[model samples]
Target: MQSWLDMLREARAQGRRFARVRVVTLPLNDYSRFGVWCSQFTNGAGEDIRYLERGKAAALALPDHDYWLFDSRKLVRMHFDDRDAFLGGEVIEDAAEIVKHNYWRDAAWHHAIRRDDLATEQHLGRV
Candidate 1:
């Protein structure tokens, strides 16, 4: 747990100095399996993530604020404490790649659209 906190502190420092902070939103349910959350952010070489684990949860940020949640339906997304900060971040215009999706069929995890950042909680359909 201490190491996880350290990584987050480092990520925050990086966020401030290099803008590595990526904020996203996801639908979360307490009853759902936690492994789904762990696999998302854990893609990077780190201990907080489970890498390929299928049904676990990972605390992306400290204080259990935001998370990467996965549902039994194979839907996964990152969650941010503040939707405004996330949607309006520089990742939209700067990141080399970006992905976005809605609970829709045609989209199916649409990727390569930097403009996807514009879709915030306000734009999201009813949960």
Candidate 2:
């Protein structure tokens, strides 16, 4: 955890920006709650983390998968196993796909709440 925070801090110190839009369910599960706890450190390190409730995102027809978009051009779409374990990601640079991902990012960002605000509003705490 310290190492991870160090990396984020270093990246921010070097002028690299970070953003994440997490789709979460109401009454968050243990993992989701833990992620909220972790976000505190990362957010302080300059990561612009936000949360979009699953139902709200579904209403907007947002894609279900998580991804990392870089420079509004390159995207690293994450893949997960049935048990929700990380299964690595596929890098995509196709113009059309990048546009699609950026579209979702824009929509999500427009509606999502910042992590701390969501945590407070939802009364989130360690599970």
Candidate 3:
């Protein structure tokens, strides 16, 4: 975890922005709670983390899976199993796919609430 935080810090130092919009359900599951805990450290390290309720996210009709968009160009789509266990990621370099991912990122980022604000709103103190 320290290494990840260091990487975020280094990226910020290099003037690179790292951000994520996590779509979560009303009653957060164990995994989602864990992610919220981790976000505290990541946000402190300069990564911008936001939260969007699942119902709100549904209106946007974003992808069912998670992805990482690099520089609004390259994309790494994450895959999961039936039980939601991690599988792997597939890198996509197709321009059209990249554009779609960028659009989703922008839309989610625009509607999501910042980590701190969400924590306060949800009464999730330190967890």
Candidate 4:
């Protein structure tokens, strides 16, 4: 068992500031466009990507349905296999679970999202 957020907090405590973090919705291509009318971003999601939407304090709390998290310190690089677990809300405490589960597939234009900084672009929409 691991917590991506906890690992990040600990790293921060040791004077490490996260430069960037990323949350890719992953391609839900299995479903047809009409199959999904619209999907809500995890939390703090501006548009296409969701960052560390909350501060250390708020993240520790996880708030409501926006509890999904990723830890840059713990995990890096996005791949294709990491789709289900990330969106499924499993191991959400540690966003790095994406890496653990190999859920990201590095496609073109992928980026990393961090709480302090965000990749600006409004992304909440229907397929």
TM-score order of candidates, best first? 3, 2, 4, 1
TM-score against truth, every candidate: 0.19, 0.91, 0.94, 0.23
lDDT assessment of candidate 3 = 0.89
Tens digits of per-residue lDDT, candidate 3, 43-94, equal 9999999999998888999777799988878899999999989999999988
**What tens digits encode model 1's per-residue C-alpha lDDT throughout 1-127?**
4575556567655652111122233442332224333333432323232111112112311222222222212233334445435532122221222222212211222221121222232243212
Per-residue lDDT of model 4, residues 32-127, tens digit only:
222222222212222233243224324344222323224422333222343434433333335455543333322111333432233223332533
Question: What value does the lDDT take at residue 43 in candidate 1?
Answer: 27
Candidate 2 backbone collisions, by pair: none
Kindly report which residue stretches of model 3 are placed more than 4 angstroms away from their true locations once superposed: none
Candidate 2's displacement at residue 83, Å, is 1.5
Error of model 1, residue 61, in angstroms: 26
Best by TM-score: 3
Q: After superposition, how far is residue 26 of candidate 1 from its true place, in Å?
A: 15
